[model samples]
Target: MTAPTPDTASLTSWVGDAVLAPSVHNAQPWLFRYERASGTLTLRADPARTMPHADPSGRGLHLGCGAALFNLRVAAADEGWEARVAARPDPADPALLARVSFVPGPDRDTLADLRPAVPRRHTSREPFGDEPVEEALLDGLRGAALAEGARLDFADDWRVRELLSALWDAGHAEELAPEVRAEIARWTAGVDDTATEGIPSYALGPRRYDGRAPVRDFPGAQRERDTAAVYESRPCLAVLGTHRDRPEDWLLAGQAMQRVLLQATLDGLSTSLSSQALEWPELRWLVRDPRSETAYPQIVIRVGYGPEIPATPRRPVDSVLTVE
Candidate 1:
């Protein structure tokens, strides 16, 4: 496929669709610069958006940016152009994670189908109904993960519960660490409308003892003091994994995370993500099922039927996209 002619206007539209991707705390830790002369789009990480406490290594930030990158690929394909992508194209430029050159290719898929679910997918921290996700739907989710070079494992046994509990314990250990705790507090702006990034108060949901693995509450005392509506119970949980642990693997995992979430949204499923366990190195190892030797755990996703939470606000496209 030959590279497409540069079009500044069309590139801007593609960047707009790309930013609609979900990020941890809605940090949207990505910046795009498109060169009209070469039809190249550069993806860079915004260090300012990094979560110092919660994501010290910038793993979450990279993951968020990678998710946006995946969206960019889909968006370009939908625009009848093929995106030839290279991760970290320049060795000296650590911030520049990817460069995508547009080219002419078969326009078989429309990201417009995924577009509708872009805004529709929200982190449903609330509980889910007792019903199980259909096997076919689960398979579809697995396929979505594989397409991005990752794996998804569904946990449905007592042994899996034991492993999850251990990992959750390890995550709690990290949360208690002073440095990690400080970072989390710094990035987690309280439930206020004024804040641009971080988890919001309204989205926090109610805190109740469900006698099961629970989503981490970003809001500490403030959340406990407030009386919010009760969430459902017994939401389905799936673990996302990758075979190798590398920078590129992490990026691919992020893309798979967003793809699976968007697919779930399209399938009329509410989803939430818990990386607390995966955040702690000690706990991350425990999350890996003994049965799976080839794959390493990435993120834990909760899926089920639930109420449609309010959409989280995003920064304007002009702030993140630069056209030249």
Candidate 2:
């Protein structure tokens, strides 16, 4: 007998969950097209949302789309469908990221377990408690990344210091670049409750007054009412990486990134991501620990206990998804 296929409504609902995936600056640079006839959902990169200055090579764009693809898989599993995904299905079409075909199947408990965290996982920019994360939980996070064919290494004290210094240098470089500043301003400008995308003022957290927090300073992110607080003195930082650096590797890293983040959320940890150093080619190399085997540092993750922050805005499903 032929397997059951997901309807348009089901696909649309899955896409709803998919958009919640984190992106660079919350740009959400992805598009989804669902074909009812074939029960397939196509993930595409939206060129219009590309950040030329900060992400000229489109690595960030691919990572964001990859994250959205991972969410779709989780959504499918939660809804009792198996999502058969093909990354870079079309060799000729660079914009086409992945194609997922859904069929009725038993729920994947592993992925369904993370569905609850989909909505709850937001970047916490506030100060995190000094309490250390348990070793067991940290091990689970490592497993989560490995399961997705990526590696997550917790930075040692010396490496953490080097990463912070690289970030400081990258941040200073970003401030001096007019084009990069303009891009930051474009996304963060006049963000309000009604806004569908970009980092809102309330979610930007306060400017760093006196801490080595690896938070990206969005232009004009702070308001007069906000006050800076001391972030965790010793942040629990991890480097998510892949063995090879390629478009496929980026997608894999992104899936691993979301899986790690969601698992952290379920483990009662506040999390934030920093790509400031990775945005700079030289600093990106500097941030990687020479002693470690993992290559191509994709993202720097901050994991600890902190206050829950509000979710960043996302474009409505209708705005980013199309059904046929």
> What TM-score against the true fold does each predicted structure earn?
0.91, 0.97
Please list all clashing residue pairs in model 2, or write none if there are none.
Answer: none
**Cα deviation in Å at residue 181, candidate 1?**
2.0
lDDT (Cα, tens digit) per residue for candidate 2, span 91-207: 899888888887676846578889999999998888888898999999999999999998898988888898899999998999899899889887786778788888888887876
User: What ranges in model 1 sit over 4 Å off?
Assistant: 1-3, 110-112, 211-213, 219-221, 228-233
Per-model C-alpha lDDT, please?
0.75, 0.87
Top-TM-score structure, candidate number: 2
TM-score of candidate 2 relative to the true fold: 0.97
Which 10-residue window of candidate 2 scores lowest in summed lDDT? 219-228
* Candidate 2 Cα errors over 4 Å, as ranges: none
